[model samples]
Target: MNSLKRIMVGLDLSEMDDTLIRYTAFLCSISEIESVYFIHAEKSLDIPQEVLESMPTGMPADEKLRTSLIEKVEHYFGPDSRTQVEVLVVEGSPLKELLNLSKVNHIDLVVVGRKFHMRGSGLLAQKILRNGRVSVLFVPENEEPKLDHIVVSVDFSDYSLMALERMLTSALTKPNVRITCLHAYQVPSGYITLGMNYEDFDKRMQGFAHNKFAQVLERFPSLDGRATLHLVKQENEDDMGELLVVEAKRLKADLLVIGAKGLSAAALFVLGSVTEKMLRYNDDIPMIVYRKENEEIGFLDALLGND
Candidate 1:
C-alpha cells in the first residue's frame, strides 16, 4: 500500500475546505507526516482584461490565490503545526492538476472532500482514485477526523490484503483503534451443476468463505486480538458495494478502506467493479482507496522540483 508521509490536500475554497483542512491537520498530528500541501486548482489563473484594468497592483493571479489560501490555512490549520506546510494555487483541471501534482511531488497520499448534499462527481473521484499512484482518502463534509474504527473491505485479493495490513500500521491505526475486516460473499448461480439446492449451496459458500478467512488469519496471526472479521452474504447479483456501505454504517465505522486496482498494462484501468459501486453509493464514512504506488517513472514523476 502507498505510504502516508507527504500528503496533499485538495482545496476548492468552498465550505468543504474547512473540514478538509481540519481533517488533514488532525491526520498530520497523528501520523509521521513530513510535509503537507494545501492546493487549490483552477482552469486558468489569468485575470480578465476588464478586471485587470481596474487593479492597482499587478500581482499574479496564482500568487493572489496562494496568498488567500495561506491565510485561511494559517487561521484554521491550528497553532502548533510541526510539519512543513505549503500552499499552492495552480491552473489546470482540478482532477488532472491533482494527479500531476501527486506524481511531481512524490506525494504518498491525496486527501479530498466527499460531499453529500453538495455537488460532487463519483466518476471524477473514481478517475482520481484509479489514475493516481498514491492513495486517496475521501473525507465527508461532516465526518469527524478521528480514526477510531476502520472498516476494511476484504475479498482476500492481494489488493484487499495490502489495504488491511497497511491499515494496521502506526500511520493510520493507533493502539486503541478498532479494526474490522468486512467480507461479502455470494453463492454462484451455477450451483445446480453440482446437484446442490439453493440452501445447501448457500451454506457451502459460507463455509468456503470462513475457510478462506481462516487461512488469511494464519498469515496475520497478530490479528488475533487486533482485528475482527464480519462476514455478510451478498443476496443481490450487484449488491456488493451497497452491502458493504450498509454494514459499515451499521457498525458506525469512522473510516472505510478498500484496495485500489489501477490501469492494467494491456488495457485501461481495471477499476474494480465493486469499488466503483461503493464510491457511487457511499455518502458518508471517509473512505481510502489504498494501493501500492506504481513503479513506472516519467517526466513529471522524475523529481520533486518544488523545494
Candidate 2:
C-alpha cells in the first residue's frame, strides 16, 4: 500500500466523471495516498475559421473551454479538503496522454469510470487496461466506494499472488472489511474417458481443489485467519471469467480484485483472456487490476544468465 503514493484520475467531463473523482478522494482519505491529479484529455474540437473570428479578442475558444473544465473540476473539491488536488487539461488522445502522464509521474493507480452501455468509453477503458502500465481501478456508474466486502481471484501465478497480497494489505487497514480469495478451476475432458465413475471423479476433483487452496494458505500464512477461501468448479473447462462474475454477484461483493495478466508470456502486451472477459461481462462491480512491478536486472546478470 505504501507504493500507492500518487494517484491519477481520468475525467471525461461526463456526469459519471464526478463519481471517479469522489471515489478517488474517498480512497485518499482512507489510504496513504499523498496527492491526487484530475486530468482531462481534450480530443479534436473541430472549430471553423469563421467561428474563431467571432470569438473574444483576447482568449481563444479552446483555451477558454479548457479553463472552464479545470474550474469545474476544482469546484468539485470546493474549499475544504484533506488531500492535495491538482487539475490538468491536455490536448491529445486520451489513452495516449493518460499512459504518458502515468509513466512521467510514476502514478501508482489510474482511476476511471466505465459505462457498460456506451461503446466509446468502454473501448477507451479497455485500451487503458491493456496498454497502461500502472494499476487501474474501474468504477461503475453510481457505485459507492466501499471496502466492506472484497473478492480476489487467484490462480497461484505470481501475478495473481501479487494482486492478492496487495488487496490483503489494503484491507487490513480498514475496519470491518472482509476478504474472500476465490479460485475457479475446471477438470480436463480426458479424465471422463478414463472409465472413472462420475461421482467419484467429482469427489476427487473437489479434494484436489481443497488441497491447492490449502497450499495457497500455507504460502501466505498472514492470510490464514484474515481471509476466506472460495472454490468454484466449471464443468465445461471454459467460462472461468463468467463463473467469477457469477460468484461475485452471489456473494454481493463490493469490489473485485484481479491480476492484469496470468502465467502466460503471451499476456505481455494484452490482458489475459479471463481478465478481459470479466471486464466485458460484469458491469455492476468495480474491479482493481494490478500489475506487479518488474525487478531491475544488472548488466552482468543480463548478459551471463537469465534474470
Candidate 3:
C-alpha cells in the first residue's frame, strides 16, 4: 500500500550482508516488491602502472571479485526465492554508486546494513542517511527483523505525518504489530529563565502534548484503538535523539520509524538533526527513514501566485 515495488540493497560482503538480504526477502514476501537488486561497489585501489599494464583490461580484478561476490549472494538466496533478484558489481565509491543506482532505477526503498565499527558499512550508512533521496532502511547486524513493536517519532509536521501514514499502511499488513507514536518536547529556555517552576512548566507542557496527540489522532480515525501515544519531557541537557533511542529500547521495539527531514525549511532534502543524531547513537535497532512526497511547482506559480 505504501508503493514499495523496487528495493535496492547495498552489500559490503560482510556477515551482516546475509542479514540484510534475508530482511529484504522477508519484506518482499509481505509486500508487493517486483525486484530486489543486490549491489556491491568494489573500491578502486592504487596499483603500480606496470602491475596494472600486466593485467588484461578485458576482465579486471574488480570484475572477478564482483563475480565472486554475486555468486556468494546468489548461494545465500538459493533458487527457491519467489522474488526476482539481480546482482551487480560496480567500481566506484559505494555511497555515490548506491545513490545513483537508486535514482536511475526509480527505486522505492534502499536497504543497507550498519555495523559497530566505523570503517566500511557504518561510514556508508552515515552518508546514505544524509544524502539519499529515496527511503532507507538501516538493518543492524545479527538481528532478525520482527517488526513487532514499532516506535514512530512524530512532531506533527508534514514529514512526520508522511512517516505516520507509511507506518500505518505497513502496520496494517502485519499481524499483532504494536505501534507507539512518540513525541519528545522541551520547555522553552525563556520560560526557565523567567523563574517558572519546573513542575508547573512540565504540567503545562504535558497538557499541550496531550491536546496535540488528540488532534493528530483525530486526523486518522482508523488508528483510534490501534496505536498508543507517548509524550516525553526533554531535560535541558538531554538530546532528543538519545531520548528516542532510550524509549525505543525500553519499548523493546524491533523497528524505529522516523521522517527523513524535520519541520525546518532547510531540511527540504537533507537529514534532520534529530534523525542524524539517532542514527549516530543507536546501532542495534533498525530504522526506516520515510521521505515526503515531491510536489512540483510550475515556473509561473513560483514567480507569481497563479498562471
Candidate 4:
C-alpha cells in the first residue's frame, strides 16, 4: 500500500507448482501498482570438448528454459492483473539479478517464494536485512494466500519497529483484523565462568524480556488497541525459524512477518541454502521480508500477508 508504484517478483520455472504468482498479481491489481516486473534467472553452460567427452548425454541451452519460464509467468499474470508487466530473463544468480533489477527499475517491493527453511544463523539474511535498499517479501508455500491474522515478529530494534508500524498501516483493512506482536527467547549455549546460579540468570533474563516487550508497546501509538503482545520462550528444542513457523501455524495466521538481514558473503557461497530452505517448507503460510527503513516500512503488513 505504501504508495507502491512498482513491484518486482522473482520466479523459478520448475517451482510452478501453485498459484502463488497469480495470487501476487491479484494482490497488486487491488493496489496502486503502476507496473510489475517478472524476472526469471537461469544458469548457463558452455560445452567444452573435454567436458563433452565426460558427458553421458547432451542437453539444450539454459536460455531457452529461461525464456519459456518467463513466458509462462506472462501468460498466467498478464490476462488477470492487467497491470503493466515487464519480463526479464537473466543468466547467473537469481538473487544478484533480482537485486540489480530492483535498483535499475526503482522498484519498491521485491516479492519472492521461499521454498525451504533457512539453517544456522548466516550473514546473507543479515545483509538483505541491512542493504537490500528495497523491501522484500518471502512468501511461504502453505496457508492459503489471504490477508487475515498477521503475526509481527519483533526484536525491539529500530528496524523491527518500523516493520511493525508498516504492517499496521498497510495490511489491515477490515475491522476484525488481528495482529500479534511476538518476541522470542532462548537460552544461550555456552559455559559460564562465574558461579552465578542458572535459575537466577533465567529469572533475570525473563524479566528483562518482559520489560522490553512493555517498552515496545509504549513506543508505538499506532499499535495501541490494534495489536496484542505475546512472549515466546524458545525451548532449547527449536530454532528461530521453526519457532516462528510453529506459532504462525497454531494461530492459523494468514501471514507471518519477520525482519531479515538479507544475505552475506558466506550465505551466497551456499547458493540459496538459507532462504531456499525456508521457501521449501510445504506450508501455505506466506511471509514478507522488509528492509528496516522509514520509507520502505509503511503499509507493508498488508502486502506482506493476505487479508
Predicted structure with the largest lDDT when compared to the true one: 1
> Candidate 4's residue-wise lDDT over 123-239, tens digit each?
232233334667776665432457757888787876567767666555333447678877777656442545556666666667877788778778766566777777677777665
Instruction: Output the TM-score of candidate 2.
Output: 0.82
Predicted candidate 3 versus true structure: per-residue lDDT over 1-307, tens digit per residue: 6577788999876777878877887777666677889998856644344644534466766665556566666765668767788888787777778878988998877898878753353777666655555788888887785766788888788878888887777522464777888888888767778679878888888888788878878998766787888888788899888899888888888889997663234443345457778887777898888866452323422232211
Ranking by TM-score: 1, 2, 3, 4
lDDT of 1 by residue, 249-284 (tens): 999999999986645552232456677678778888
Model 1 lDDT vs. the true structure?
0.78
Return the clash pairs for model 1, or none. Answer: 263-269
Which portions of model 1 show Cα errors greater than 4 Å? Answer: 47-58, 119-124, 265-272, 295-307
Model 3, runs deviating above 4 Å: 45-63, 75-80, 117-121, 171-173, 189-197, 262-265, 268-272, 295-307
Ranking by lDDT: 1, 3, 2, 4
Question: In model 3, how many backbone clashes occur?
Answer: 0
| Top-scoring candidate (TM-score) | 1
> What local distance difference test score does each model get?
0.78, 0.73, 0.74, 0.60
Better of 1 and 4 by lDDT: 1
Error of 1 at 84 (Å): 1.6
